[model samples]
Target chain A: MRAEPQSFDRVLSSMCTEPHPAAREAAERFLATNPGDPGTYPTVADLEDDAVSLLGEIAGLDEPAGYVASGGTEANVQAVRIARERAENGRPTVVLPESAHFSFQKAADLLDVELRVVPTTDDGRADLEAVRACVNEDTAAVVGVAGSTEYGRVDPIPELGEIADSVDALLHVDAAWGGFVLPFTDYEWHFGHAPVDTMAIDPHKMGQAAVPAGGLLARSSDLLDELAVETPYLESTSQATLTGTRSGAGVASAVAAIEELWPDGYRDQYVRSQNNAKWLASKLESRGYDVVEPALPLVAASVPTPLFEALRDEGWRLSRTGDGELRVVCMPHVTRDGLESFVADVDRLETRVGLEVAGASE
Target chain B: MRAEPQSFDRVLSSMCTEPHPAAREAAERFLATNPGDPGTYPTVADLEDDAVSLLGEIAGLDEPAGYVASGGTEANVQAVRIARERAENGRPTVVLPESAHFSFQKAADLLDVELRVVPTTDDGRADLEAVRACVNEDTAAVVGVAGSTEYGRVDPIPELGEIADSVDALLHVDAAWGGFVLPFTDYEWHFGHAPVDTMAIDPHKMGQAAVPAGGLLARSSDLLDELAVETPYLESTSQATLTGTRSGAGVASAVAAIEELWPDGYRDQYVRSQNNAKWLASKLESRGYDVVEPALPLVAASVPTPLFEALRDEGWRLSRTGDGELRVVCMPHVTRDGLESFVADVDRLETRVGLEVAGASE
Candidate 1:
């Protein structure tokens, strides 16, 4: 017999969440269709176009061109690969802040491009001066993290675009986690805001879609055309997706979720989630723990290692950041009750073990 | 609103079929889970282990070290990437036959590796001599096609293994579409057959799992370790997959399908599909059209273009090979009744428009 799937009640660190009802129904309906071969499955293919159109609207692009990638990793990797191909020069290099997601490292390894890591500001934003100093003629692309993994900080995308333009390099915004909520904020991190070449936004992350529903949006058609290869099999004449036979589950789910909740629904969700994150942050701070500001519905707190482990022992699905901080991602599934329960466990555990006596822990 | 999904009633060319009942149920249950972050979704991760174990048992491997890929494309690409990493040489090259899938081209482009394309024999199998001539000290890998896309031909695996051995290169067998059936046939195309270092066999294709259940089996754990990247986010310390945040749908479905059908159930399926392919091939031959012998459950026939268009107009979802032959893949969903309908349409079309009078149309 197969094992049961994990429950989402205690999951606090995962970027993924329980899919919406419409998304789940649509995913189940089209689970067997292959979106890679558009000719063979034109219905799902059209739905993919719908998903991209919605993503384009969300990212402030009038004429968006891209495909549904496997996930953020594939989208980010393809973005760097496109920049490298466009460079058409000597050994290419990619410049990014130290706070960039690890998937960029995967991209550098896959594309054989050199990586020039720049330091981030004290508040976790990309250090613009450091990025400017690192980017040279060899730089094929400069990355700006709209929603960093640990700190949830939005880098200066327009300034990074200027730096990339100085070297004729592309500006790829890693907005995989922030695209959904940044629109509700005053942050300038999209196509209309700057000279953005491409963006990685995932419906699976904050858009309440099923897993694998990752969006890669390009400002110009030429950027996507470079990825095309001859696909002389079915009705389609060419293919650009990394995988040959992609399931329609993610595509249909993205379309369903976007159709059900575009501007208004997502805005409400962002407000609720941001409030929950702030609530949890204040609660942690009140309990004598240092907490990062809840910038975008993600909280990072410095809890004693023993208390963190004790909470884990109490069945809280928790995780730690690269920097010894307890990370909490307020996905749609994470409710106020869940956070309250987590805090209650932390307080109970702290009382049982003398916190001052234990001191700092790993 | 999203477009409705296409029906499988007329799909004759797709490598994927309607997912098995057990597989679909499991996939729906785990649709929101992310197998890429196994530290959080341990249940589905365990199922992934179950799927890989079943794949190893079928591939004649004692211990398997691999993961569920997005599809045959990711699996094949990773196999080449592993070989290239192990090469530790400058500008590593990959030697493959003309019959290899186009996904290899994607891999070559992504990994910055040179590709030496060798020709195939008249029988559609890889020319052993051509492969031997192309492989050299710089060759990182020699590919053997267990099942060519255009033809149901299994290349000479053991001979290709010897040629790959001469250069101390890795041998990767692309059994993506053939792995499930080759076990029932007398084809030496597994870890036990030759010095096979890795294999690409998709559970989504012939194993009746949902799309994206591609498998990569390695002879040793070192091959997979070469692809690992530090994933200091969730519970798992490292991840080897090409994509991050992969859906657990594929892993759970692969495990469920394998549990339902391993040796006997798959053997029965191969017998039925192979018989269907032979029946269709003879029917086309009897109707006075040239047909390629169905070595497996795939049939290729030389059909005139106008009639092919007419058949398509009648809503018979079809495709052609790179060599312009009508390609019919007898997947588990392709019924004998469907083949009879297709044959009837072909005969009626030929009679309405004289075949010789057209003088062969494109």
Candidate 2:
């Protein structure tokens, strides 16, 4: 006997969203290309340059020095590594909000840098006072989150930047989820408005590109140049990337996705997803669920563990927050109809629970 | 008017070989799949498992614990990180041969591990006496290269393994290029013959898979478990990868390539490439070039700087050795006809140089 192979289409419960149709098409078109060793394939390298330029424009940098990395983890790791190298302090430390992505922890461990995790406020945003208190003379970087993983709350970046400046620490913004959508929204969380020295942004998350299309942008080339290491065996003189022999398919797809969505295409899609999130939140709230007001496309609500398990068994994919709240992210593949059907199922479960309580009381 | 995008097929001078047709087909089949966040797509994750299993079998490891990483650099970094964590020493150091890949330099920098680079012998293999002298109680890992980047030389892995065992330090084998070719040859570099604790292998190299298909295999699951980190917001509890939200295309392509070339397919291809390399080496030697006998499929030869530049001008893509020798890697795409044409051009240039010298003397 053999087990049935899992289907790609059946994944509905992932926070890492699916690639857009155009992104998929782009990846398929460049399946044979590799951008890692750039000597043979200059085209993919050019595409990476274009993608990085477009990402810099979106993030409000004039001319950024960056590359399309593997994902947010690599980008964040690179950002921290740059800070560690640039800092003159003997003991390097990085300050981060409690809501920062787990990649920071990984970076802290891998780079052997001290991590000072500050708690978030009641509203699920980074505490500005806590960040200020955490920074010291040895602080290398102060990390702020935009579109946090659990609640999707943007940190107070302008204030954090000021705190970092007081101690001469580099400010790095983790905008892996917000870099795509926030540019079109009313939110002020880009490098243009904030004093961010470096940033980690992911086109795969909200730009609707294929998976693994993440970028680490530096305000100046000098910061990135500090990380370059010589490669004597290859044609290239030096490489600054954390990984060698990367796939160019991600860069190609990201370029194609950005070209299709640039100027206004992504804005329209964001508007749709944002509206869907708000609509879903309202539907849940009306049914007696405590829903968090969405800053982006994610909505968090409290639910029993049994209900969560039931939902999973029903083939509806979902995630949970650190405080044990159910999280629903409204990506392009998650439609309004799908949310409505999910709401109906929740309503039925609530009604059954109410009847069971009534019978027990009798 | 806009500039025309460069064609992917036009690249000819890259050591990064083109993807196999079967690998391309597999990638196209799962363009919309992501194996990292597996709740939504389980098939790609299963494909990753299958690919790792196949790689383990090729590396002579049974039921190896590992994942398909982004590339050789990531795999090497992860291996070093694991060694660093598992070591009980207060100050950790990694010893490597001078011919080891540049990724070790990166891992040492990223992980803050002390690197001891021992010089190689005249024949381009690691000097075991120097390596033994470098190892100490603080040494966490002793690295051996199966196929060096520039010279295609294999280090004495069995001897290195014995030295590592005596010191209780982990022995990691970097077989990124040789893992696919050496198994088919008479080389004793795999886990079956050598006492390797961990190994870094790349399917994108000679396995004919797409780029980004690098694997880090461990002798025991305990060593790999040390590198796992928890992701609170994700569906899975913890992730062992260096990059978060990686692409499944690499894993799928690797699996497809392995299935297509299993048992005897890769062996036949290796023999053909080996013959091609030997023929090219003879041709270069006949033309008065000091060519090194290829241990694998790479031919490194001394050529005049002017002639090397002229070959590049004629659109012949090649690499350079550390000692300024020309390197020609006979990959699957670099056919006998291609090598013959390259040799003819070199022959023409040599005749022209001889005539110029004669004219000057007259």
Candidate 3:
């Protein structure tokens, strides 16, 4: 059945072809198994244990100090709430890059925190210098994007960490895109080891888990404790990112994905995907597209708006970036042949559509 | 494989029993079939056509408007946000029962609305009189519960509808638990009719669909229009709940469950569940436990503080209500024999764990 695209579903597809196979199996198993009588299976203790263990593994943290939610939106909401609660002076200010995900702005609006948007560089990376200038005592938390939504450019976590340290504020990382890929990458950066106090990861994205699968990993247990509010449905002992009962299948799938991908396979996949990304970017550039710099697995190209229509007419789907650029992500499932065919198709369409190429003046 | 309970997992389990037959077939089909390219999957036009057709089947509204979200929480959050935007006067006030699920409170906190906890009767149903009194010019919406979390009691909707009309406020029914059951019952209540502005239902719950499946039906299309936010990820025309790429698997499973159950099977299942609930509640009462009032398929026993330990020791898992009650729902797959065994087990554990009989003088 064809249905309208939801943001969660679109993001999942845009980021990855599918969840890890093990996650799907775990989901099937969860569906097949009964919760058992009471204390045996699917109890609150069981839930907490699963969450804590998963968070610990995903973030490489000694202790997972938070709960899972529907997705990164809820995690960001909780982070913003915590920041709002810890505001010492005037209305809390949440410092995030202008290119960060809309969830950050949504969280700020929902939590009544003043969102100070630090502009990004031309390459779509968060400008650390602007963030440093904006930081003051009124700042509750400084949010750095591990993967910028528009261009998939990661902010300088180390630089943000230094800023957060200098300001004595919490560093919350919106790593919804990179949380699953970064660990698998050869990058020398680490959000967990840095001053980043909290980070959100979505399993449905790069983790290859199902939808509604997300968890918040915290560096210090104290940050979560400060934001804790007790309700009968949600308890402090439980890390509930959202209200009501969660999707067991999603959790099982996430756990399975983590188990399948961790330390080696997932890392290898990341390296491979990154290689594919670099290759794809080179191919696109040779074809006369304006490719952005520092290309990760996800790449953005600047083109005339009409190119979007022409590409769509030629049966290619590319998400438009905020600054009128188009984005393409090289997922794990994208084969070399498929990449070649895509470039060929774009070449054919470009000739047919008769669009002016970037830097064609030269 | 046993892990802690997550909201995601709960939603998933709520939709299907372990080894759901349809899920297997769907998964098998998915494995055998290549999704090809996400872009190749029908364009926005085709999906919108299907949505329009489906909307026609639901209520034949001209120019039907809606958006897809991940779950009921997002739907309700969007509804509350829209209600705030369309509010007539003063700081917005939310009126909901204490027994109502905490999501409303979460929404209120997110939107910075003052929440007025309308009192609930001892039977766990929202007090209509109290709710009426709570509504004022400042009140934007009056939330009525269709199957409350603590007691599983459906509030007096007709009365609440009248109160909403009088106060010129919207009535939002949080049917996260009861939406699937209500339609199957012979009750002459219509949640989507006049006066009731919106209703949020989780298909994953009683619908026996997969998790991350929820819908918010509004009588007025204007509510959706008012709540719409134009983020780059989610275009307003195609969204009803939260804007994002959603899980098509959820849609697949939900449609599958509806096709398999909605006609006569769902009704029969609800009838069976109600019977089991009645039997279980009767047995518990016979064992001297104080039962919560306004009987629904779900029941809560007012257990003495010590009884929880006894039940746990006897290998029964349950949650305690805010005022120290034990809430239990008779799920679709819960057989009568299982309920009988559980009741006997609870009774045996009470005496074994040194808990005094229910209602005995302290």
Identify the leading candidate in terms of lDDT.
1
Candidate 2 chain A: worst-modelled 10 consecutive residues by lDDT:
A1-10
Candidate 1 local distance difference test against the native: 0.90
For model 2, give the RMSD to the true fold.
2.6
Query: Every prediction's TM-score for the first chain?
Result: 0.97, 0.94, 0.86
Error of 3 at B236 (Å): 7.4
Reference-based TM-score, model 1: 0.98
Q: Tens digits of per-residue lDDT for model 1 on B201-257?
A: 999999999877999889999899999989876778888999998879998999888
Q: Write the per-residue lDDT of candidate 1 for residues A1-362, one digit (tens) a residue.
A: 55888799999989888988999999999999999988678889998888888899999999899888888888899999899889978799999999999999898888899999999988999999999899888999999999888878999999999999999999999999898889999999999999999999999999888988898999988998877777766678877777889979999998999889888888999999999999999999998899999899999999878778887878888889998799999988999998898888888888866655555442
What does the lDDT come to for candidate 2? 0.82
Using lDDT as the measure, what is the rank order of every candidate, best first?
Answer: 1, 2, 3
Instruction: List the candidate numbers ranked by DockQ, top first.
Output: 1, 2, 3
Residues forming the 10-long window of minimal summed lDDT in candidate 3 chain A: A4-13
Ranking by TM-score: 1, 2, 3
Q: Which CAPRI level is candidate 2?
A: medium
Model 1: residues with Cα > 4 Å off, grouped in runs: A355-362, B355-362
Quote the lDDT for A89 in model 3: 73
Candidate number of the best DockQ:
1
Docking class of 1: medium
Candidate 3 yields a Cα-based lDDT of: 0.63
Per-residue CA lDDT of model 2 for A1-362, tens digit only, reads 02133542323355556566777777766655666666655567788899889999889998989999988889999999999998898669999999999999899889988999999999989899888888999999999998898888999888888999999999999999878888877766778887899998888888878766888899998989877888885677888888888767778878888888875988887898899889988887887789999888888988877677777777776778888888988877778878878887787766776676678999
lDDT of 2 by residue, B43-161 (tens): 78888889889999999998888998888899899999999998898679999998998889999889889999999999999899999999989989999999888888999999999
